[model samples]
Structures are given as structure tokens and as C-alpha cells.
Target: MSQSPPARKPIIEFRGVSKSFGTQRILDGLDLKVHYGEALVIVGPSGTGKSTILRLMCGLLEPDSGEVLLGGLPLQAEQLQRKPIQVGMVFQQAALFDSLTVEENVGFLLYEHSKLPRTKIGELVREKLEMVGLDPVLARQMPAELSGGQRKRVSFARAIMEDPTVPDDETQLLLYDEPTAGLDPIASTVIENLIRSLKQRGSCDSYVVITHQETTIRSTADRILLIYQGKVRWEGQAPEIDACQDPYVRQFFDGKIDGPIQ
Candidate 1:
């Protein structure tokens, strides 16, 4: 008989991770993994450390205890600077610099870090803009001039921008924190489709999305993780969510007022 193929290591892993802020605890002994090419969605009640998890994964906030590994190595600020697998984040509010034009914002990383000429950076910026369904001409417009959906698309373009010269500096993982929070249903659907299209286009190897919108969860997740009281309380595929009997899963997804979640 042929031997089973070796298990693939996770692109991102949290081992017994815990975090606290002043007097309140956020994460407690939480363990999680994001495999390559996976679209993982995390859903939970507000203020339950969902955003905190995204911050930890991107090295903005270190865990109070336990380890966060990226590409199977411990996540460190210095390592993030040179890590072969890059990680990018799209904040809930589409945190574009208000002072910069769309082109400037999308190409900020290259402008600040690389020695590439301005014309080359401009070409890459327009390419990414078009990829995200934005007209290249919009590159000259400021962030304040764009609508909510446009702003989100600009942020997406920014997140996926990579330097072609640095072959090792590819963005392999993207963390989205409540990407569709304030959009209307139609706009939300657009963002949702973009999320799927980005992955299918091989822009990133994997992504972790933190969202509460039922439609978003259904549209993007390959697997679902429900966090309650700082730990994973349930896990299942998108289709399994409706049939799951776990109190936290039912309470959160069904919008019920009474359950273990309270």
C-alpha cells in the first residue's frame, strides 16, 4: 500500500495563545491554525477578541502568553520585516491615509520601502487598481472623494500589492477585520465577491476573515470557527453551521437571546 501524503504545516498557527488588556482578558489559551489556500471565517459577539486575533496574526500586537507562528516560525517584529511570506491586513474601516490619493495609498509600501522608480510603481498601482475593479484614472483621486465600496476596493488593492523585484516578499496571508461591516447589502455582496475572486486569482495563499454578517460568512468561508469567552467553542464547514447544535454556534448564528453565549 502507498503511504499517506505528509501533513502540510499551517501558514499561521496560534499555540495556547492568551492576551489581556489592563483588567480584562481577551484571549485565553486559544489555539488555531490556518492552512494554505484556506478561507477561514471567525464569528463571535462584539468585544470578544475577534479584532485582537487579527492584530496578533499581523504582529501589531503580541500575545501576553503563548506563541504566534508565521510560516512555521515564531512571529517577531524583525522577522516580519524579512519574512518570505508576507501578511497584509484590511481594517474594518478601510484605513486608507486620508492625505494620500488612491494611487499613493495603494503603492505606499513600495514608495516607502523599495528603490523602484516612480513610473514603475505607478504602473503596478494601476494594474492592482484595475484588478480590484477600479478604473486606473481613480488613482489620482483622494480617499475622501471615493464612496464606501470604492474605499474598500482601494484598500484591497493596497493589501495585495507586492514588489515584483522581491520574489520572496509575496503576500501569502491576508487578515480582514470586519470587511463588510458598514456596507449596504449590494455593496456587501460586491466586497464578498472580491474576497473570493482574490483568492481564486492566487493573490494570496490563504486568508482569515473576522465578520458577523451571515451572508459574508456563507460567501467566503471554507471553514467556520466560533469564538466564545476567548476560546474556540465550535468548528464546522459553512453548510454545517445551520445544523450545528453547539450552544454558542446556535445562539450566535440564530441571533437567539438565550443560550450559553450569554
Candidate 2:
């Protein structure tokens, strides 16, 4: 008999993780996993802890109870210095520094931490800009001058930036919080496609995106997770979304007020 394929390992895992603010519990004994080399989209109503999950993954927040693991190891404050794996986050608002030029913003981490010369960093920034379909000349322009879509693309370029000097420091996972928010349908499509294309280009091994847009959820996810009332209410492949019978899934996709979501 043929042997079964080896089990896939999760790049990120949450085990009985819980968090709260005052009396409001955002996550309660939640368990989730992001498998290697897959695109995972998280969809939910506002204030349901989707963004909080991204913050936890990126080390911006600590769970009140339970654990957040990276590459099968528990994530701890002291171990952050060693950086077992680099995790990059693209904020929902683009979050560019208004005073900085596109090049400065894209290469901010390297400029602050790497010993590389400015010229080399500039070249790397330009390369990433082109990869995101932005003009190289725009590197000199301030973030204030770019359109919303352009700013988001610039953020994408920044998230994928890596230091060539550190061989193991490549970004292993990317977290996007509402990446295509506040854009026209056409612009949102562009951002959504870029999210997939970057994975195809091997910029990051895996990515987790938090988006409520229907088109974004459909276009970018290999798998989908729906969070509700501080837990994962539904999980399935993207193709299975339409056929999913879960009340939370139905309420969310159908925009109905009479279901379990509210």
C-alpha cells in the first residue's frame, strides 16, 4: 500500500489563545493554524477581533491566556531578538510616513538597522517598487503625493523588503489588515491580484489577510476563516464558501440580519 503524504506543518498556530480589554473578551480559547505556503483570508464583522489576530501574529500584542506559536515554537518577548522568522505586516491604511519619500518609507527598516550604503538600499527599493507595478521615479516622491492605490502598493513593496546581508532574515510570513480597503472596485482588484502575485513570486512563503470585501475574499484566499463572537465560526476552502451552510457564513455572505452573526 502507498504511504500517506506527510502532514503539513503550520507556519503560525494559536492554541487556546484568549485576549480581552476590560470586560470585553475579544478572543476566547481560540485555536487556529496557518499552513505553510497557503493564502488564508479572515473575514468577519467589525470589532470581532480580526485585526487583533494580525497584531498577535506580528508581536504587537500578547494573548491574555494560552499561546501564540511561530514555526511550532512558542512566541516570547525575549526570543524576539533572535527573530526565528521575519513577519511583515501591511496596515489597512497604508500607514506611510507622511513626511518621508516613497524610497525612504520602503527601505525604513533596512536604513535603520542595516549597515548597507544608501545607494544599494535605493536600488533595492526601486526593484521592489517595480515588482509592485509602481514607477521607479516615484521613489523620490513623498507619500502625500501618491494616490491611495499607489500608497498601498508602496506599502506592499515595503513589506517584502529584506536585508541581503542576513541570509535567514527573509520574511517568512506576511500579514495584511484590510489591504484593499477604501478603494474603487478596479483598484481593489489590482491590490488583490498583487497579493496573489507576490506569493507566486516567492516574496513570502505564506500570508494571512484580513478583509471584509467580498471580491477580496474570493480573489485572494486559498482558504477562508470566519471569526465570530471571539472564535472561528467557520473554516473552508474558497470554493466551498458559496456552498457553506454555517449560519455565520450564511449571515455574513448574504448580509442578512436574522442569522447568528448579529
Candidate 3:
């Protein structure tokens, strides 16, 4: 019998990757892969380089050694800026400018990158803001005038402003950094619901959400990778997490620092 051809390659691949700042190693010969249309959540104790993963993918930083592959090919700054394969990011602080209105912030990237008319950009902004469940009126308000939740929503809208369209059947990869941080329970719920909706309604092939909120993880992740001391030490599905026998995994999940990490 003939074996089927090897499966399609991963969308993003990190092989024997080691990253460092001088002598401080942030990623230790790490090997991880993210496939098309799979949402992967990475959680770990503080200082484990979860954010570094996003930066590497976005070309914000270069690894000290090893390779980072995008679409089964090696990556570099020049290629990332070109088009199509572009990714979206929601930073930890929601990083919105207090001086700009929601509309302007969302339209910022579109205006800079595209020759679309001013009128067309406005329409895109309104449409995306609506998709995130924000009032068009809110779009006209300055960032400072909105609640923390509203600002986060605005940031999400802005991330998608240039992201590949969220389709009904395909998965768009969104790398979110601490999306629910500093929000109240209600706001957190809204954010979680939005995450779930993205999985259900959009063509989001995958997402990597970095957060310490257990509830947020419970609601959004398909699988969890545990990073400690700047490397991934454990990984498992959400349900399997409760039964994880790895002491480090248990310690992090149970909030104990006196174990392997100590």
C-alpha cells in the first residue's frame, strides 16, 4: 500500500530556537510548531518568554540562534512586511493612543498601508467596530473617554483593521497578548465571549493568547503549553490539564512556587 504524502507543513515553526539578551536566555533551544487553523495557548510563570514568541512571529525580534519558519519557510524582516501572510496582535496594555478617537485608531494602519480613499477607510472602521460590538458613536469618542473594556475592544478592532478578513469557514491567526488583563469580571466575560465567537464564526486558523487569567484560559484555549524558566516544560489539552502529573505543571496551576521551579 502507498503511504499518503506527508501532511501539509505548519504555518509557523520554531526549531532548536534559542533566544537571549546577553547572557540571559529567554528561549532555550525551543522547538514548537503551530499549524494552520489551530488555536494554541501558552501559559507559564512570569519571565518565561511567552511574549517573545509573538515578537519572533511578528519580526519584532530576532533570535540569538536557531530558526523561525513562517509557512514552512525561513523568516526574515523583509518578507514579513510584504503582504498576505501578515498577522494581527493585541498587546498586553491594549496600547491605544489617548489622543485618537476609536475610528482614527482603527483606521490608522489602513490609512498608512493602503491607498483606499478616506471615505472607504471610514466605512471599514465602522464595520469592524460593529463586529466587535461597539457602538459607532463610541467610535467617535477618544480613547480616554471609553472604559477599559471599550479600549481593549478598540485595540482588537484595530488589530483586525489590516488582518486578513475573518471568514465564516477559515481560521485567521490572531496573536493576543494578555487580552483580559486589568478588566473587571464582566469585561473579562465579554472578551472571553468574543474569543469564543472568533473561533466559532471566523476563519481563525489559530491564536496564541498570553494571559494569567485562569478563567480566560478555560474559556479560550484548545490546548495549553506550560513554559517555565524561559522554556516550554509541559503541554496538554485543556481537560487533561487538571490531571497533569508533571510537578511543574501542577505547581503553576495550583499557584505554588516551592516545587521544581524553586
Candidate 4:
């Protein structure tokens, strides 16, 4: 007897997603699939539409022609409900409220979303900060007073505070936008190590990290997807990146000046 077709399981799927600004296209027919518990790193030149991907995932931006499906569900205009479907985001700038204290910032989501008392949220916030290797005493400090790395780490703590799970699958995804963009070598390494640890938290939680640093790229990524000229030219394991045959991937990986990319 003939067997039935196998079922398809996907935590997130981008189908022919394309985006444009004014007249210029940023993403063209970009199709990507992110499974649960997979760490996918997207690397490319400055204007290669890397950030667009994250925006699309969060419904902050929509594809001009295609669609973004979360948990097999398409995100429409009204369907863009800010419901916490187990997703968290960490922006490069730390994007914390300078006016708010660290504890308040970390508890922002919990305070607003949960019916829990402020004291409970505050306790949870402090716990989250400590989990990121920061002292709970830093909670009363302001963002401006912290160093760049500390600020980023604090923001990461905030991102996960709403999560209630670090490396776990309570959330389907964690979107990182240039998580290591403007830091010194040591700070960058710290962030990279945090990314690795996040993966260990759960077997069902996956990540999409947008970065340009080679070390950041090499350390956190299990798979690499190269976006060139608004298109994904190639993809594979991080260790296999140097051996990739695509000129765009090769030029970027080897830090070359002259290639088909330029």
C-alpha cells in the first residue's frame, strides 16, 4: 500500500518575502525557514537587507509582495496583534529607556503585560539581570551610567525577562539586530558567549542573529546565510563558510575588496 505524505513542521517560515524602500529593493524574493532550536545567522554587507529580515519577522515591516508566516500563520495588517507568541528581540543600541531605572526597564513588559503586582515584577526583573551575570544592585542604576557592554547585557536581560526562559523553548524565537555592532573586542566576546549560552537554555527555542563581525559570526552561528544584493546567495554551516564556492560569500568571508560583490 502507498504511504501518505509526510507532515511539515515549522516554527517560522518566510515565503518569497520581498521588500523595497521608495524605488530601491532591499529584499528580493527572500525565502527562509527557521526551525525550532536552530541558530541561524544572517551575514552580508552593510546595505544587504539584513535588518529588514528581523523587522519582517516581528511584523514591524511587511513584504511588498510576499508573506511572513509565524507558527504556520500569516501575519496580516490587523493580525499584527502584539501578542507574545513566544518571541523576544534585542536591538544593537540597547534601546533602553534612558529615563527609566534598570529594574524598571527590565520589568517594562512584565509590568505592562502581566496582572502581577509591581513587587513581583521587580523581583522577576532582578532575577533576570542576575542570570545575565549582572548584579541585582545594578537594577537601580540608569542606562547612561552603564558602559556600552553593560547596557547591551542589561537590554539582553530585559529581552529575556519577558521571556521567563533563557535558552528554552517557551518562546519560539529570539531576534537579534546587530547584537555586536559597536563594541570593543572584549565586550563583543562577552555578547557572543551570551548568545551561545542562550542556545543551551532550550532545545525548542531558535534564534536569528544579524551581525557583521567575523568573530561574532563565527562563534554564535550554527548555520550561515549570506545575503548579497537583496538576495540570499548561499547558506551552510559556519565552519564550511570559508570553503564556500560563491564569490560573494568568499569575498565577504576573506574580507576582499574586489569581487563580484562590489
- Model 4 Cα displacement at 211 (Å)? 0.6
lDDT (0 to 1) per candidate: 0.93, 0.92, 0.81, 0.82
lDDT of 4 by residue, 1-262 (tens): 9999866556678888889999989998889988866889999998889988998887788889887888778866325654335667898798999999999899998776778788878888888887777999999999999999999989888877653433333455888999988999998999998887866864127889999999988998888899987888888888887677788878988889999787
Task: After superposing candidate 1 on the true structure, give the runs of residues whose Cα lies further than 4 Å from its correct spot.
Answer: 1-5, 77-81, 168-171
TM-score of 1: 0.96
The CA root-mean-square deviation of candidate 3, after full C-alpha superposition on the true structure, stands at: 2.8
Better of 1 and 3 by TM-score: 1
Worst 10 residues of 3 by lDDT: 163-172
Clashing pairs in 3: 37-205, 38-205, 170-203, 171-203, 171-204, 171-205, 172-203, 172-204, 172-205
- Evaluated against the true structure, the overall lDDT of model 2 is 0.92
**Tens digit of lDDT per residue, candidate 3, span 28-69?**
988888887677888987788999988997778888889988
Could you give the candidate ranking by TM-score, starting with the highest?
1, 2, 3, 4
**Could you report the Cα RMSD, in angstroms, for every candidate shown?**
1.6, 1.9, 2.8, 3.3
Separately for all candidates shown, the number of backbone clashes (residues 3 or more apart, or on different chains) is: 0, 0, 9, 4
**Better lDDT candidate (2, 4):** 2
Put down candidate 2 lDDT per residue, 1-262, tens digits, no spaces: 9999988558889999999999999998999999889899999999999999999998899999998988777877425556547788999999999999999999999999999999999999999999999999999999989999999999999999999888864447999999999999999999999999999998989999999899999999999999988899988877887888888888999999998877
Regions more than 4 Å wrong, model 2: 1-8, 81-84, 168-171
- Cα deviation at 30, candidate 2, in Å, is 0.6
